[model samples]
Target: MASLNVGGLGGYLREQRRTAQLSLRQLADAAGVSNPYLSQIERGLRKPSAEILQQIAKALRISAETLYVQAGILDERDRGEVETRGVILADPTLDERQKQVLLQIYESFRKGNGYGADDGPAGEGGTSSAGTADAS
Candidate 1:
């Protein structure tokens, strides 16, 4: 079955923040939240309500709807397929290569004819799908 990680949204946000090189205080200021609270959320020690999530999303310049879906606050349209993949790939335990692998599989699965069953096999049955593979 397709799965999602409810905890991933926080980590993803944290990564984005870091990529933007914004300090917690700066992000919090931009998002209009307390630094401590934003820190807690980044560390996965706290969860934000939808309204707060929207604010954070705005600060991150991403869609709140996308954040909700990643946070597991919203169900994925493809029977949780997208959410599930995001959760797994978002895991902090994964290295960059692993994350890339997961993303490849997810993209292939998403575009495949059958998601799970009649669905076509993952790109290489265990390999990352670089370009050139039929998305179908």
Candidate 2:
């Protein structure tokens, strides 16, 4: 797992906020926090609690686990998979809604069957067992 300190966490939060296209004030409003507090968090001047992180993740429409990992509240279980998620989150082509949906589906598959890169729902050809593109 990456050793993410307050600075790293703050950077990660800033990146996510930018990716979501939300101003600090807007995110603070959505997360029920003060704008100054959110600013402090993003500037590495404050360490928010797990509850606050959860709230921020909700407001960002991202997985709370992702924030938890970045905040060092939880150790990353799978570095490769987590990196994949980071790529997905950081993809400039995909919109926030698309990214969120892809992340949700990926996480569900991981939790449901302990899937890895080699054991994805789709096979090597990138097609489902039903011989069609998997919409879900």
lDDT of 2 by residue, 16-90 (tens): 999999999999999999999999999889989889999999999988778888888765654457677889999
Q: How many residue pairs clash in each candidate?
A: 3, 0
Top candidate on lDDT is 2
In model 2, the runs with Cα more than 4 Å from the true position are 1-4, 78-136
Cα misplacement distance, residue 12 of candidate 2 (Å):
0.9
Instruction: Highest TM-score: give the candidate number.
Output: 2
Error of 2 at 3 (Å): 7.9
TM-scores of the candidates are 0.52, 0.55
What are the lDDT figures for the candidates, one per model?
0.71, 0.78
List runs of model 1 lying over 4 Å from the truth: 1-6, 78-136
